[model samples]
Target: MFGPWWKLGVDTTLLAFEAQAVIGLRLAKLAAGGSAAQVEAQRMVSEKVLAAGEAAMQIATGASTGAVVAGYRRKVLANHRRLSRAPKGAAKP
Candidate 1:
């Protein structure tokens, strides 16, 4: 049950990490070809924005995965309960 969720979480984290790395590379490009001072300032701002974006992505991904797992568990449990309560050795009308 939880195995699938763990796998999904790991895959999500990896994807997010890759996306952040791509963004970091693009930011580096954008921060390039400027006066030393200007480049430094822009680099600082880019770093902050990139960090914030990565953090937000992680949080959102985690929350969404948790919600999906919770919903699935709830559904499975409900079905199990329903089956447990069903009469045995009876024919359907």
Candidate 2:
């Protein structure tokens, strides 16, 4: 439950840090290169890395949201079950 949520956050943060490191390395390579082709390749690699990071973040966010929703749904269902088990004074219209 809450454990999974915390794990997800930690996992996502680690992924993001890795992605940033990759992008930084690519940038450094691009800066150290003398040829235009090398620079262009590095730029492409950086773009791909950033795109992957964005996708990963999106997936993590979606998972977190789904977990929260599911937890809320479970709580609501439990409350409903409790209410149903109580004695009612009047019948529903």
Candidate 3:
């Protein structure tokens, strides 16, 4: 902890992760043996996926995504509501 005062403020974890990811993507691209256009397309797709993940993170922090979850939950509750009040093989008089 006493090595350097400046080192404590800087965390290299994310920088390391990005470096490793670049290496991994390079290896994957080489293994694919595709044309330049295909490699470019793959790169674009990966970037888009990263953007989507970022958006999901933003949605997680915001209050709007809850509405989508609530809509699905409401449908599930509607489906089960009738079953709770009625028994199978029983008929109304």
Candidate 4:
């Protein structure tokens, strides 16, 4: 397993895995006009990936102070909340 500092987006393979996790069985959902759900799912992936990558980068660069980690976490969580509020009947994208 990748360490906490792993940046999932930078690696094509990791991103492909993340996409598969969210979209593999959800094609039908999209076709059913489930864009909101898809968007929400993508948001979760983005939050998780970004947190891991940013945290790792911070520690790697000796910048993972308490405030830095807390701020990064807050940002990720806030983004998730925003993404999750999308309209359920939103158009498919």
For 30-89, candidate 1 gives per-residue lDDT tens digits of 466457437646765776576567556756777565554444344334434543353466
State the C-alpha lDDT per candidate: 0.55, 0.55, 0.49, 0.56
In terms of lDDT, model 3 sits at 0.49
Ranking by lDDT: 4, 1, 2, 3
- What is the per-residue lDDT of model 4 for residues 8-80, given as tens digits with 9 covering 90 to 100? 2244344445445445334544555566557856865787787788778888888745545465546644544
Lowest-scoring 10 consecutive residues by lDDT in candidate 2?
A: 78-87
lDDT of 1: 0.55
Q: What TM-score do all the candidates reach, one by one?
A: 0.33, 0.40, 0.28, 0.44
The TM-score of predicted model 4 comes to 0.44
Model 4 CA deviation exceeding 4 Å by range? 1-33, 80-93
* Residue 4, candidate 1: alpha-carbon lDDT: 76
**Superposition error at 2 for model 2 (Å):** 0.9
Q: Candidate 4: worst 10 consecutive residues by lDDT?
A: 7-16
Candidates 1 and 4, the one with greater lDDT: 4
Evaluation by TM-score, superior candidate among 2 and 3: 2
Tell me which residue pairs clash in candidate 1.
Answer: none
For each of the candidates, give the backbone clash count.
0, 0, 0, 1
